[model samples]
Target: MAHLHCLPPSVEPRVSEHMPQIIDMIKQIIDSGCAYSIDGDVYFSVDKFSKYGRLSGRKLEDNRAGERVAVDSRKKNPADFALWKSAKEGEPFWGSPWGPGRPGWHIECSAMSATYLGYSFDIHGGGMDLIFPHHENEIAQSCTACENSNVSYWIHNGFVTIDSEKMSKSLGNFFTIRQVVDLYHPLALRLFLIGTHYRSPINYSDVQLEKASDRVFYVYQTLHDCEVLLSLHNNVNRKDSIPPDVKSCINKFNDEVLVSMLDDLHTPVALSALSEPLKIINDLLHTRKGKKQELRIESLAALEKTIKNLLFILGLMPTSYSEVLQQLREKALKRAKLTEDQVLQKIEERTTARMNKEYEKSDAVRKDLAAVGIALMDSPGGTSWRPAVPLAMQEQQVVAV
Candidate 1:
């Protein structure tokens, strides 16, 4: 979670720590006649739970009639699943009324969840695939153990794919977070992850990640520019009243972003809402008309404050934007197999070539720098170099702030 920049859970109840609770719940289910013991093994009767397949919207008969899974002879019904398994050699065991046994996979989740979050939690989330046997069984087991197992909302996120194909180790498409961050910025991957709606299938590709990195860089650059421009002004006090246009934009942000967030965590829509305000901020910063306006400093200040708050709320802001850019630059340098000294040497060569009217050599130097993921932007002030991610799909790849 830390690697992904997510906060630790409020309660970290280990399943092993809650073994007694798990055992009690299993015994309670058995006592309620929802589960049965046979040859030291316990199985939950799906028929006893009338809402067996409710969570998954699956019919019991349809599940039983499925052709793929062969019926276990030990089970009372085809849909019946294990609650506990008898102790096996070279495995850990817990003492139970049904003799030495271990709890099944689904029971541990229900037990820990009920122990910490309680029987009636607000939201229970997992992958969409868990909706079937895993979650369905959890619902049955939890509700059976406690009469008021009111899990208000059950949310499931879609799976991630690699290059539009299902990610599988066997297919040589599996990637670890550490491996990915070693190549690109962790926030780049984070941005790519949240770029789409939670319920939508996200395709992971180098190109998409490059685009996400660019978006992150653009926001940082904008923020840094705002910081510079705002620093030039001595009056840093908050304005009594912002421009009507700025006020309207902020109100719209609350309406579009915060409200959508409340309405089922519509992150994609919330992210999209930022685009307009960010463009407005950039316009105010860059254009002469915006600079000449009376409310220029005030508007920029308001925007800077608002944007930073929004990014923090969304868990998108870095502790230091400069640090993020630095890391990206370091990674880009390594990726290009170039060091700081080597890059400086190349830049000096390029500058000298340009100064001596060696146009061909200067052009070649520019190509060499670009090949190493470095873009040179020559402004009236000076020539500046930054790590450059590919600008393919330029139209689609907007700086979605």
Candidate 2:
């Protein structure tokens, strides 16, 4: 089982509500002589904790002193970290038994996790950087306050790098989720993230994302084509539908694919399984075997369903049916309110102008529709029009319209 925690927006809100309880716990630890206070501030005594570096394997002597300057000067040992900091002027503060102060960084997670997940929980997870004094201190604080080790498992996800450099806002290489989603489909982004193991660092670049997008689009196109073929043969009975061998193939895929997913979320192996069924579906659609028509239809339907379900689980399904139709309707509504006949006549005129090589007139007509939020695409089959809703408006209108 897995659990997720989204921390409060600011530490101040948590401090205002939980500081008193934490202060009392610290006082109790002090009474036990495990914690000490100096100049109205409190710090945890790392030497008293027996299992201090068990997680990171950094012994006291092996620990290189952090380069960052120490914030407070009153600590007995240089490595002793603050349990509570006296509030500075104009900063958010709560009334504590010690004084008006705020809880230190490490105390919040210990207090909140204990309050919600109880003194003992199955797992704790965060970025790799937190393994240090952050998680180490959390372990010490919770074990001391709750009188039992609170967390059973500690999981840390690796960092994201860009262009062989660590992603950092100060270095100007950081990209937000919203910014990345704007450039490529969300499914492509997810595929890129999962391409590497969760414990390995992920390197970000446009070339990599483009390759991922292409692969995802190929899968989607295969599924879409299979759906179209299956819709044409739905009238066949089960026995007359796809062949027994194809049915067996699909069953095998389901069992193997599901087992992989259930084991440890092995998505890459699951994705690989798709190729076999995709090829089988394509073969059934193109082979024109009159005797196996029914079997082919069954196989096609099962394959399409499998692809759709897997894509949904991966959060990569395309826009919904109603969403696509709504976009179509909005595009139709944005045209000049010509009668059906008049619209047909305009389309004919535009077609003729293009046929006659009247490039300026053809361009003008396309621009006219574009101004009203419709876009036209020219393909070998014919012209197709879609709504040109601004990207920002598309998200808002998808739900409302």
Cα deviation at 384, candidate 1, in Å, is: 0.5
Evaluated with TM-score, which candidate comes out highest? 1
Model 2 has an lDDT value of 0.67
**Compared with the true structure, what per-residue lDDT tens digits does model 2 show for residues 362-386?**
8887777655444566867777654
**Looking at candidate 2, what is the lDDT of residue 79?**
76
Q: What does candidate 1's lDDT look like per residue over 216-235, in tens digits?
A: 77778788888888888866
Name the lDDT value of residue 202 in candidate 1.
Answer: 81
Q: Give the TM-score of candidate 2.
A: 0.70
Please give the RMSD of candidate 1 to the true structure. 2.4
